[model samples]
Target: MENTVLIKNATVLPFTRQANGSLNLEPQIADVLIEGDRIAQVAPAIESAPPSASVIDAANHLLIPGFVNAHAHSMEILEKGNHEASPLELWMLYTYPPLQSQHLDARLCYLRTLIGAMEMVKYGGTTIQDDLLELPYVTPEIFDAVAQAYVDVGMRVSLSLHTINQPLHHTVPYLSDFLPADVKQDLEAAQGLSDDAWVDLFRQVYQKWQGYRGLVTTVLAPSASQRVTPDLMHRIATLSEEYDVPIHTHLLETKTQAITGPELYGESVVAYAKRHGILTHRTAIAHGVWLSTQDIELIAEAGATVIHNVVSNHRLCSGIAPIRELMDAGVNIALGSDGMSSNDSFNLFDVIKAAGLVHSAMDTSYDRYPKAADILKWATYGGARSALLHNEIGAIAPGMKADLVLYDLNTLSFTPRYQLPIHLVYAENGSSIRKVFINGQLVVDQGRVLTVNEADIVAELQDRLPEYAVHRKQILQQAERIRPAVEKMLSTAVSQSLSIHRFSRPLHYVS
Candidate 1:
């Protein structure tokens, strides 16, 4: 028998756009009827509920589509708050290098991925574009485990085989010149998977797992131009075409990255992407913080998505993405939590709040500012576009997949609320989450995940933390050894004058 859920008397956000370009709610209390995994009806009373359907009384609740974390890294949940830095290279060196040495098995991979998925779903995230990179490299077992964990958690995930083709020393510009002989040797000697090896890995994972149960999908992530070769980027582009799946790439997240395209390809990253045939409707540009005006135009023309990780950007001091300009250029803007290592939580509610507020300070034009509903759009529909699943999810409508978030109207965030959409964007936190339905499954009920024993997951993971701490301490010690060189490189890179300015951090700060 097909499972059905009848949610009763819920005020919902239809995410409808007004003529003045602001967002408004549907202005109706409606019942959402779900049959199997699809929304059967959304109307007044929903009178045709089947006898076998489970009824959920959702009175005094706000039902909206679950938010999509368009770009995220799965493994970073284990390394949360281990290191903090404001610049990209320094952030990577301090935060990521330690994990590269931590040997991981399938179980660890599953746990790492589960924690991330659990966090996302717990905080109103239903779908995510997971850029899952195994530390050092990806193995077939590790890859499958990550994807399976998402399904086991009942979350929709587009998992990417995240790897870079470029050597470590070459990935970063001018860093090799700044390092000591031994340090440079260590970095230069660091090898990643070859083109053929990566392709084989992709084929292995793809053949086994993609499009799993229609909840799991696959994306080919070439990491970035700074970390990926042109040939690999082209290959990934081809795969995206062949599979009809979106491709995600980190583009111009930092000033140093913004410098790479000009230094190496004699153009901007957007132009370089165009040259490599990577600029497409299927391409998702993660952290396009340093893109130029021309770059934005090209991306809009190509119909690519620009994923905004506002919390991640602020944490790494990566600067504000030109979201207003991009939106004006008709570029699809999506939101992400990045990874717990940088953003510290997969709670995209926080990300949604950050996205709504961060851009108000970036530009002077009040009219161009992203309204609260705009942020919701980015969180929902824009995110669906990031994974090329716009038609199926991202909205609460009949005939669509039943992925919905029920927020308690009694929460403080909605207290004395005059407007629904505005209050949701500005004031609400995760406390408002009453229940979450994904693909017609009650994955979260009464604000608790039902797929797995979260406490047991936590307990089991906690049992392993003592041994992991030894690795954590050792990696922290290792990070200190290379901090001086990394800081020097950062200083050198910061000293040069650029054609433009992205970093709002003044050249000097006053006490």
Candidate 2:
């Protein structure tokens, strides 16, 4: 027998936009019927349901689609606060080096993923893109463990085996070179592992966990264009085409990357992608902070999606993405919190707030600013579209998956709320999350996760924090010790390059 649930007396914020630019925020005092794994119906009130049906009274709550976090690195959840103040390159150098050492074992990685999943679910994010970047210890067991953690927590996830072809490269060219020699060499060796090995690993993982009970899916992530060689990119793209799955990559996130793109490839990064025919609807580029106007148009024409990690960009000092320009160019835009290490939080609502504020600041036109509803759509529908799960999830309409979040409007944040969407975006935070349902299953109810013991999870991760702290302190100390040497090396290199440029200037100046 199929399970059914009916949520009654809630203000339904459909989050669906109309033909006109205005949002359809008509507060519907309706009953949302969930039959099996999809929304059965949305009506003013259902007279009766099956006797065994579960009924939830949502008298003072707001029912909306669950938030879809389009990009995240769940493995970095444990490394959050330690690297918060450092610049992007320095932080990566200081933090990620330890993971390549003995710090990140399978057990620790799984625990981090579990904790990350819990944080995301607690904050009303039903779906997330787990961009698990290449770990030397990454194995089929690690993939299964991560997937199992998500399933155990009842969160929808798109798991990507984050791949990089040149893992040993220092500083990614545009970024500072801070990687230690040993760490760089180890990563390079890992990257040299045959593509056939990765394919075999992915095939095993996909067969074991893809679409596991309809909550988990597999995605091909090539890490970033700069990190992977052109041949590897082509192979990954071809693999994605063959598997009929989505591909995720980081693209044009910084000015440095934009400057380096032409040097790496004969053309711009987007142009190179276009040449390889990898700029398809199945591709989603994260960040895209420095894409050109032409690049935006190309993405739109190619039907690709851009996931704007506004909070991560600000935290890392990466400039704000031209989201307004991309939207105007008909490019699909979605929102992501990035890694916990970058943004320092997995809360999707926080990300929405960041997006609204940053875009509003950029445009300087209040009327043209990204509205709450616009971000709401991006969080749900645009996210699903990015993951190529548009038909399965996103909205609260009938036939869509029963992925919904209930926000308690009885809280002080929503006091005397004139407009629901505005209150949701500006005032409310994760504390307002009353319940969440994914795939017709009640994952969180009354501000707690139902599938896992929150106290136990927290306690377990807390106990492991001491060991992580040792590693954290060791890495930071090592980085601080080596910092002077690395800085001197960079300074010498810069001076030599400048001298060459100065000496090479034309001697016969007609002017």
What lDDT is reached at residue 46 by model 2? 88
The TM-score leader among the candidates is 1
**Where does candidate 2 clash, by residue pair?**
none
The prediction achieving the highest lDDT against the true structure is: 1
Model 2 poorest ten-residue lDDT run: 498-507
Model 1 agreement with the true structure over 168-266: per-residue lDDT tens digits: 557656667666787666655566677899888887878888778779888888777667778877888888788787778899898777777777678
Error (Å) of candidate 1 at residue 110 is: 1.2
**TM-score of decoy 2:** 0.89
292: Cα error in model 1, Å: 0.6
Please write out the lDDT profile of model 2 over residues 6-86, one tens digit for every residue.
Answer: 899988987655786334666788899999999988988887778888999998889988889999988778877755543
Off by over 4 Å in 1: 16-24, 98-102, 507-511
Error of 2 at 352 (Å): 0.6
After superposing candidate 2 on the true structure, give the runs of residues whose Cα lies further than 4 Å from its correct spot. Answer: 17-23, 98-103, 174-192, 470-511
